[model samples]
Target: MDRDMSVEEHLGELRRRIIWVLATFVIMLALGLWLAKGAFDYLQSIPPAADLPLHAFSPWSGVRVYMQFGFILAAAGTMPVVLYQVWAFFKEGLLEREREATIRYIPLSILLFLVGLAFAYFVVFKMALYFTTTVNRKMMLEETYGITEYFSFMLNILLPVSLLFELPVVIMFLTRLRIVTPRRLQRMRKYAYFALVFIGTVITPPDLISDLIVAIPLIVLYEISVFLSGAVDRKIRASEARGSLAR
Candidate 1:
């Protein structure tokens, strides 16, 4: 809906987007039910080792696992479409430059998300698995894991990290809007550290090593966000200055 549109019009647009998202989910779920095996295999690939036994607690847990896996794939595939719809809905209120800037952030956002997903897969998942299974291995245990629980754990580990990976894009947008200055972020360094540590503890498993591993990347990402924000702010200001000069 355009800015001139009434509240009813905006509500109509929201309803429409919601319908689209729901329809997408239904279609994906159906497809997922049919193709759960491949989906499960793909999800399993995120872990470092393949030999871990996966058991289903319920009689139909296998079906549930595959269906859920399909849904996950569907959600991932539809992310860009969802984001585009969101952008379209909001674009009318933005200046041309702002619209362009937001459009530019889309690709970077996707890239950052993928990076985060990879980080979760490569770093967190492996470490978590190692931590959990190491003790069992030491005890000479078989370590049979329930399929649903394992997948749920995997989701918990990956989803947050993937979401976290959007730090750069977030900081970039804030920088673009001048909501947060580079110097402001720099000044908040100590606070950021405490927050990162807190976040690491909250998200990771109870072990100190896991907490430390997760925290390090988060801190590094924060620094990266600050640097990128500084660069973006400089570029936006330079562009604005050039525009003023031309005018």
Candidate 2:
């Protein structure tokens, strides 16, 4: 498995992994749909949304939102399997220690994703929603919201934050593979902060506080990524030195 693979062999392996991932996704999708109603009810019961009325402009809007929820649930459920498949696909090319280290990231990646979702939902999202609603109240605008639009906005905020939270894990993995190093990340700090600030502004309302709230965590995460990458680099170098000495 460590040796070079022919094109056909590679394709066959890829096909097998794809099949496994797809099968898992399908099962998860079904489970998601079955649980969607309860989950939707719980969401509506949350304090921010408790009194907010959701109108379905069209008859299909409710169904669409239900399906959207299903998709979200399915995606979350399938993420670990997908990550494992990805790691397995590339693992044959890795040294024994590298393989072991990378495999541990799958669960950690999933945990970080959940943390991101919670942060967005509880803190960032609540603040943004309150700000907008308060403005609407001040302007004397009726606060009618479409069910589809509401869910869409929620997903837009939740999904990206969760995915972006994987940055540290991704950087650490790439560091192990030698595709990137701490030195490169350190050199790119200013540019990275600018990019993250832009992303924060794009995702958040035009309020400076909201922008900083999102941007600051991202900057911190990037710094954490740099630190983790440096640690991994040191470990790799130490391991290599040990191997050379033993030889």
Candidate 3:
């Protein structure tokens, strides 16, 4: 992270940041592989998974699953570094107030992301898995789940929901930057609902109950985002009023 520079210097800076990000990713991936065993155990001990053992159909299935888990862990762990790099890259273009605002909310974004992960795993994932399994049983179908498939299904749900949890922070940031306002969010509400519901449908099991279980929280997140945006918009207006009076 550095100040404004000549064109060549800026290119060098960009390359240096890229190297740092790649290095972080490699380190995190290694650490993730080491921790994946514990994660595997924990997942197996959980409710839906605990009910039935997962099998590997292919010779490379175990390796693939471990790698996927490691990749996910690495991706999650590297998020802060990624955000820092992004902020650093554009820091020179941002006002002091914008830089400060961006820095202040990064940690909140990370916290919300972690909360989303937990919510997806504990609630949405469970509901979807239970529904799918119940359907198979109702149809009198044999239930043999591959480890890879089970986890792939899981990652599909976990990542999106976790990202949705960032809605409020994203709205607050956009509002602070004057790129988004409460009125815009309100006007866009119905379209956003359609998109969120569509996403919820795509990610969850193809069932109304599962879709609602996933979509309802997402809808709530949007509402909370609108509320937060309104609050930030109000503060901005008040600050501008005060500054004008001072002038």
Candidate 4:
């Protein structure tokens, strides 16, 4: 961060950041394991999991389910830490104001993630559960769900949507690194919409309103990402111009 680092120092800094992130992950993973039972019970108290009776066909079914929740919970807990570390790693390149702006993402990322988790769980996951259950019932199939299989389906649906909620943060971080620009995000807007819409349609109940409800927020997040990226880019350019003028 002194901006006088040799290549070796840069590598060493990166290594330290990685270590910190990993350490946080490990600590959170332990906490997650300790809390998984209560969390697991809470998940079961809700719909979908509440409706389905869990069977443990394999001896490892319970363990696998525990691990899944633990891992995701740890990842979620570690997210803010990761963002801060990333910001620190690139500290030297950023102006003081820019650095402050970037650091604010640490908490905002947590808020966004919690929002994503709620949306995914309460909205998308429920709709998906209803659809699949309805189909199974319509086909006159007996619905017996293995504990492992259920969490697998649940997590698969939950994790991606929740993570996509972090798109804006990820975009902002990359923008800070000068890896992606506002213009680049703008160019990809159409494709991004297509993909997000596809995901929305796949997850939601097959209704126009439902699709729009899910897709719109995701689309809006993308726009926000673009906007924030542009904001940071403008700041960076303005700072450079000032430096050049001073010189």
What lDDT tens digits, residue by residue, belong to model 1 across residues 28-61?
A: 7677666778767776665453666778889988
Scored by TM-score, the top model is: 2
In terms of lDDT, the poorest run of 10 residues in model 3 is 90-99
Worst window of 10 by summed lDDT in candidate 2: 1-10
Error of 4 at 89 (Å): 0.8
**Model 2, residue pairs in steric clash:** none
Residue pair clashes in candidate 1: none
Candidate 1 deviant stretches above 4 angstroms:
43-49, 139-142, 177-179, 202-209, 239-247
| lDDT of every predicted structure (CA atoms) | 0.82, 0.91, 0.88, 0.88
Better of 3 and 4 by TM-score: 4
User: What TM-score do all the candidates reach, one by one?
Assistant: 0.83, 0.96, 0.88, 0.90
Per-residue lDDT over 108-152 for candidate 2, one digit per residue giving the tens place of the 0 to 100 score: 998899899998898777877888899999999999999898878
Best by lDDT: 2
Deviation in Å, model 1, residue 206 alpha carbon = 5.1
For candidate 1, the lDDT comes to 0.82
- The residue-by-residue lDDT of candidate 3 on 1-247, one tens digit each, is 3455788988988998899999999999999999998988988897878898899999999999999989888988888998788778877766566678678778999999999999999988888888788899999999999998999998888888899999999898788768999999999999999999999998778889888988899999999999989987887788789779999
Superposition error at 129 for model 1 (Å): 1.2
Q: Candidate 1 vs candidate 2: which has greater TM-score?
A: 2
